[model samples]
Target chain A: MCGIVGYLDKVGTEGGNVGSVLLGMLTALACRGPDSTGVAVFGQHRPDELIAQIKLGENGNGTEYARKIEETGKEFGGREFSQTSAYLRFVFTETNDLHAFITRVEATGDPVEVVSVGRRLEIVKQVGSPSRLEKTFGISAFQGKHGIGHTRLSTESVVDLSHSQPFWGHGYPDLAIVHNGHITNYHQLRRRYEQRGTRFYTENDSEVVAVFLVDKLQQGRGLHTAIESIVRELDGSFSCLVATDSALAFVKDAFSFKPLVFAETDDFVAVATEEVAIRNAIPGDFTVREAQAKEVRVWSR
Target chain B: MVEIDAAGRTTREVNRAIRQRIAESCKEVVLRNPGARHNLAVAILEDAHIRIAGSAGYYCGGLIDGPSIEVEGSAGWGLAESMLSGTVRVHGSAGSGAAAAVRGGTVVIHGDAAARLGVSMKGGIVIVAGNCGYMAGFMAQKGTLIVCGNAGEAFADSMYATVCYVGGEIANLGTDAVIAPIDAGEAQQLEKILSTHLPATLRSTKPAAADFKKVVAGRKLWNFDKREWRTWQEAL
Candidate 1:
């Protein structure tokens, strides 16, 4: 099992320190997933281009990383800039060989992990506790209108940095997800996506959720529509939080096997694995409520 | 009366100390600055009086036996879950699945409650002074849910032996749970039960049982009759 938290500023002026609140929410869920933690934050949006958050894996050196970035940037019509020691930011034209570009970055053999791909979404995550991650990434310095976070238990995949959660919809802009519970048909879905040449990074069932969603979004479906389809098509006990540059939303499994709570106020909307996280993230008497079985809720600024 | 501050301690530390104190001749325990932590004061089998001054997180006073617990503030999910014998009073609201699957207990809620208030309960007595959300007693086998206020959708779906009484509107009733007539004797019995467990102010202001609607299982569901089973299988 895992934990998820999603947030959106409804009033639009709350340029909240989204990373700080996300870390607090993730900290509340540390007991649920002690193995690793991840977060996806959406800041200022860019219309004509998509940004990718980068992390150099085991074999990435400055010289080789520059060469790989040069190669992928030329192919994708993009450019790269450093955000932090572990995080590099890349901007790409919307209609380039984006799929191939991601594959190139991922398949560098030594692994240049593309943590997220979106117009404003930049996911910073690793194999550590929530508090530890905050120290390493200066996540508290990130300011945004909305974001999503997760603490993963690592049930289906190896306990590695790249396998941590808040999976990015690699092919879709500004789409990321943090999920709790399992996907019963992940192997079948993985095979289907793999047959279609979709490159998968980890064996985590949650990664399949991001891939599945991007597939639907790429097929001209809206966020709400894709989530509704997911409730029907996917069979499992999952409660997931999804984030986009414009919105934050969540969907629960039909049986509601996993715990997910959300709070709504005039200024903001917050969702988490439990109300405790929501309580800590949002201040003052927001109306806290449970996500009903099979409920899909969306909120935006 | 014994008082303990839970401001700077983990749930483990608080619960361990509370349990230890209860074992060492502590009859009344007060926990201040609860910090709304999960699983606070869980699995106590003593007959002590435990009072939490601040809000509590999930499963507060869960599996409680023989204790009379009270919360001055709100509580999170599954409050008093699976308790055998206790009197739990929540002065503020409670989260979903409160008093779920209790074998024996008396839980009184002074304020509104969230969804799935008492799921799959085997036996218990639940009294809510305020409205409750959906599926208040879903799949309950045996218990009694008395709501002085409104009830949300699908109240008591598929309930086997559990009985429900609501003074206000019911959005929907689940399978096998139907509105049944409240005889004079049953109405008086519910009032007696409420009086015994409710606070003095609430007991005095209790709604008349005659004004409430009674709900119970559709007896046929209690037995897996061959005819009913065939009907169910065909539907499936």
Candidate 2:
């Protein structure tokens, strides 16, 4: 099991230090998933290009691998690839051709995954504790209007950077997914998606959900419609947070076995796997309510 | 003698400050009017003598270890759930599922406890001064529950190693739970344990009034039935 939290605002300045709020929420949920932590902050600047978080080897080749990927960006028309020790942040220019570009990159030996993407949405993630992610990526540095974050516990998949969430809908800008439960039908879905030329990097079932939702959204479905469609088709107990460039959506599985709580106010809206996460993210006296079964709620700024 | 008034502070700030103090320089801490502050406290104060003046929300002293915690008021659901070690005392009533999955330590509720007390307890001692709701001591593998008052019903359903002592009437004993007489030696051991964990107000009461009827698993559920068809034909 994992924990997912997201916050969006309709009025007021949503762009103020939301990174701290996201980090605080992730910290509250650290016990749910201790393997890795990640956060995506939607900044106010250029909203077209999405930030892809990639982790290279720890043998001092992080920067070199990032430069190599940056150079490879020329193949699919990407730019501005930056590198750190085991961290890579780059902007993809050709959003439409991002799927093809990601496919080519995964053919290489090095592991890579699109952690999050959105209009001005920058994803920061790393292996280890939530505190480690904050320390390594300076996740609190990014300020945005609203964002989604995740803390991963490796129940089914190996504990690697590639399997960490929230996974970006491959090639889709301003689209990201964070899941809470296992997808039992992952093998079937993976076969179908793979046959259609979709490349998968991790053995996690959550990645299939991300790809499925993105496929729906890219095929001319709205965020709410796409989420509702997946909720009906997907089998398993899951609660997910999907974010687009201008929208934030939550979808609970049919059974609603997994826990999800939300607190909405006039100023901001928050959702988390547990009520404690919502309390940690927005520190105020507010009534937290549990999400209804099979409910799909959406918020857009 | 560090007294932290958590009143008017957000749960986060209170938790952060209390955790910091516990980490830095505090062995014993006291919180005045803790009921007004709604955050998890005993969770952070492991191995410390922490006293709460008022009631606590869910999970008071949950997963506690080494620390001796006392709550002056009642406790919400799942009190001491999965508690590993140490002692937790609730002066008033406890909500449902108190001490669920406790591995060790002792929990004493001066008042009544709701349903599912000591559920799945691996080992420990839980003493309820008052009556308990239904399904008390369900799935208890290794532990002891002493109910000074009447036990509701279905006591020790699916119980294994745990022993239950009921002072008053028992509605029912589910599955393999069987009532056994408390001998002189067992009574002496119970008295000793009660003296250590119970408060003076409760300990002063006459032991005869609280004389308990011990309940334990019969161990019959572990084996499979292998009776032949001839036995059924003879009975017919």
Candidate 3:
């Protein structure tokens, strides 16, 4: 079982100590999953630049991999912009074909994991504990209004930075998902998406949720509708947390099998697989409520 | 009673300390600032009295095998979830899934509960003093859900074998869910479960407790054998 957490600072605490606070939340869940860790930070973003975080493994050559990423993103007028040890951020214009550009970039690859794509999103994940990820990726230095994180045990896939969670909803500029529990119908859904040329970066079912949600939104559906549709279409026992540029939301399968608790106050709204993450991240006396099965709630900053 | 300051410690440290202390069979440990941090005192198997001074975050006293845990204030979701045995008392409101999937134990909530109060409950006794939200006992397999106040819609939909007592109005019931009379044995059971387990303020007399309408599973519809499956379509 993995740990999933999401936070939205409603009382103007945006761009505060989200990095350290989220790190503390992830640290609280270290017991749940220590194999790999990830966080999709919603840092301040300019509207013009659509950024994507790529984890293609060093490939024995950072320059070569980085050049390959740059080359792959040639469509959408992709530009080589920033680099970190964990991810290469590619900037493109909003006018690009979000679906086709992300699809093509993913198809022509050494199996790169596009963690998240959004104007404000920056996903940092690694093959280690929460502390290791933070220290290695400088996660403590980040400041964002809202974000979602995951700590995984890797029961299905091999442990690696690429297989880490907080899978970005490819093509959707501001969408990310962190889920706990299995999507049993993953293979069935994957087959349909594969036939249509949707590239998958990991064997874990959580990634499929991210891709599915983005595709739903791409069809011009609102965020809440897309999340509600998940309970109807996705067949599994999952407690998932989603984050957009403006909202942070959660949805549980009809079984209520997975545990997800949410705490809200005028100052902030936080959720986790357990209450400790909410308390650790935003220590307060807020009452914690479990998200009901097939239930959905969205918090906006 | 021992007191812990949860101000700066992570859930790991706090839970570790709790587990370690309870393992030593500490008689009483009071947790301070028990605000919404998760997995506090989870899976404690001791019979100790672990009290929380303020509101507790998610899964407070979760998976507790045996303990006389008391929270002076409200508790976040899934309070005493999957509890094996013992008594957990929440003096204030509780979030969703208060006693969800409980196997055995006595959970008493003095305040209202959010949705799915006892979803998938297998066994045990859950008593909610105030109203409970929709789908209170969704898919309950076995056990007793006692709601003293009104229950939201679909209270016991698709239930298996759980006995539900609704003292107030029931918005609706799901398929195969129907009202049953509170027999003398079940009435005594309710009275005993509520009076003996609840605090003095929540206790009610036998006659008053008998005002509830009992809800049980429609067992005949659970599974259809080959013989019944053939004629099931026309029977409806």
State interface RMSD in Å for all models.
3.1, 9.0, 3.4
Q: Tell me the lDDT of model 1 at A278.
A: 70
RMSD of 2: 11.1
iRMSD computed for candidate 1: 3.1
- Give the residue spans of candidate 2 off by over 4 A: A45-52, A57-60, A74-79, A92-95, A104-109, A112-118, B1-236
Q: Is candidate 2 or candidate 3 better by DockQ?
A: 3
- Could you tell which candidate, 1 or 2, scores higher by DockQ? 1
Q: lDDT for model 3, on a 0 to 1 scale? A: 0.80
Specify the highest-DockQ model's number: 3
lDDT at position B43, candidate 1: 90
Candidate number of the best lDDT: 1
How does model 3 score on DockQ? 0.33
lDDT by residue (A213-243, candidate 2, tens digit) is 8788769987888899877888898989988
Q: Number of clashing residue pairs in every model?
A: 0, 2, 7
Chain B TM-score, one value per candidate, order as shown: 0.92, 0.89, 0.90
> Candidate 1's fnat?
0.20
Q: What is the C-alpha lDDT of each candidate?
A: 0.81, 0.75, 0.80
